[model samples]
Target chain A: MIGATRHYEIDIDKVDHMSKQLTEEEKSQIYDDIKEFLSEELDVPADQITPQSKIIDDLNGDSMIYLELVEMFKKRFDVNVEVRLIGQYFQRHPIYTVGETAQAVYDIVERGDNLLADEDKASV
Target chain B: MDQGIELVELSALTAPGVEIALIDIERHPHLEDAADQFLEPDERARFVTLRSPHRRREWLAARVCAKLLAARKGLIAGPHEARIAQDRSGRPALVDPAGRAVTGITDCSLSHKGRFACACLGRPPIARVGIDIETVSPRLRSLRDAFVNPSDAMEFHVDTDADLALLWSLKEAYSKAIGAGLHIGLKNITSNRNPATNSLRVRTLAGRVAHARHVVYSNCVVAVCFIAQ
Candidate 1:
């Protein structure tokens, strides 16, 4: 397990701006990218992944796989993010669906700044 | 289902000097306090570094179970007299109160899932031992392609989710017994189920063969592997 101490501030204004800049096509592409990555990593068929698919329960991903998925997302999205930060976000928000995870990744790309700042709010 | 720690004698599988113990940690809330008494100073220090209470409890439960199994095999007089420590490769090794490796003990493997933890101990002539416990669920089915070989699928006729879980558990036990862990691909370990005998034949990538047997207790499945020299 890797550990780091830093703050990640979710800038609502930046997120709003990025969300506004994001087109429907781009959002759909991002979702497709996530599904494709999961399909390869989990060795599951692409048809199995849906908006409602749960990463752990539906895809059989453990905590270690969750971290690996975070790493893959970082590489795919070209975002500089920490594993602990994503872990903290998931811990606080409890992402249950594939759509929710994709949305979280979008937020991380647009607004994730020192996510560990809110350590007191959630345990990861 | 009975909740306490139950010792199931593998009388048919047991060699000259071997013992197996299965502990249901959920049933032993009292063991949490008792765990501290059994842990060595270094073990207690390591326990404090765990961030999650769930992880801490699981670690304590595994240690307590390992120590109890050690005591039962006469490796130590009591749980407090033996300590389970991991080597550089994260493989567990038993140490005496004086911090010496226990003689005659070959290898021990411990595994836990959900509320269950199982430990298998082997002495001389019994080169390796591995045991794993897993809850049967649909989640395991999703990992079939990643872990199960096509030959294993055909030989075992793994059609259901429970069957996949059983295969995964058997591979995990075999890997642990071989001390390769996941470094050895799950697919590299092939398995064939003997329907008549209700046993599994596991062959590793190195061409070593071992026999495994599983027992279902409650919603969890326990698999044990023994490799004799």
Candidate 2:
């Protein structure tokens, strides 16, 4: 279950958000929301999810759930990243923990279709 | 729930020459040792890295299910003989003790939901196979729109949550068999039940006419799909 098959065809002004890097405050909110969502999806307690708490090995997260997380951000924040890019990104920057997942979501929201390495982070 | 597996429900989901399993995933407190004996070296490394006690146990239990199915089919001598690894898309795949892909086993898959786990291992003509088991619950009905379209709901007679769960399992089975796993959107896959043949018609991940079937067992919906290469 490391992949998601569901994709939305909605036309959210995702284009408007592209290239708009979120401020640290915005990113912080994104991170907390992701952690909260993970807690609900995995049925795990919120306090148990540490910065190091893994999405799969620890949280029993199926990749499909990760896809849902991506979709969630898309609807809520009008971000757009094809599932393929998400998969391709994970192949190289393999994210296993909640913090990592949050960062990835932050990247998608800011960069949209173009995913860069974490080291390429420009504005922190 | 009886740990004693009566293959009645699972039997419907099984293809010829394929080994299938549906069993309770009990926590084994001695998993560090169990992982040493039950898993491949890399699998063991991954096992120890698991922080969740729940996941560690589920991980071992799934391998045990796969090993038990393979053992019952005489495919391997023992647990240490074969290793369960992920395929290119991260689906569970079978390999030898040395990490070489096992020949003749064209397809295999694993799924865990709630306290139960399921696995399927298919031989030569099977080409590829996928199997899934969902613990029937009202939650699935509530989330039906996430995966179900009107066509599928109508075809499967989606009255109860269990029916929706079976529908979900059928689509999951096809997607996993096709090697897409959960990446293939559940909405795209549809099932039309054929009472005449006691099977569900579907398209495999390979785009061939999928050989698929499903069965219900005590609050569980188990389904499988096989496509010959």
Best TM-score among the predictions, by candidate number: 2
Q: Give the CAPRI rating of model 1.
A: incorrect
Q: Candidate 2 at B188: error in angstroms?
A: 2.6
lDDT for A50 in candidate 1 is: 92
Please report how far candidate 1 places residue B63 from its true position, in Å: 1.5
Model 1 Cα displacement at A80 (Å)? 24
Off by over 4 Å in 1: A1-124, B1-17, B194-198
Q: What is the per-residue lDDT of model 2 for residues B132-193, given as tens digits with 9 covering 90 to 100?
A: 87777665544455567678757766878777778878888888887764435566677776
TM-score of 1: 0.64
lDDT of 1 by residue, A1-124 (tens): 1121222333434544223244566667768877876787566789988988876556644443544445554544446654435655665666766798778766665554554444554645
Instruction: List the DockQ of the predictions in order.
Output: 0.04, 0.24
lDDT (10s digit) by residue, model 1, range B1-229: 1124454444544556456776666677676666567689989888776543555666677777777777666677776677888875567877887877777678878777667667778787778877777778776554565567888868765778677777878888887788764436676788877788877789865768887877777877777777788
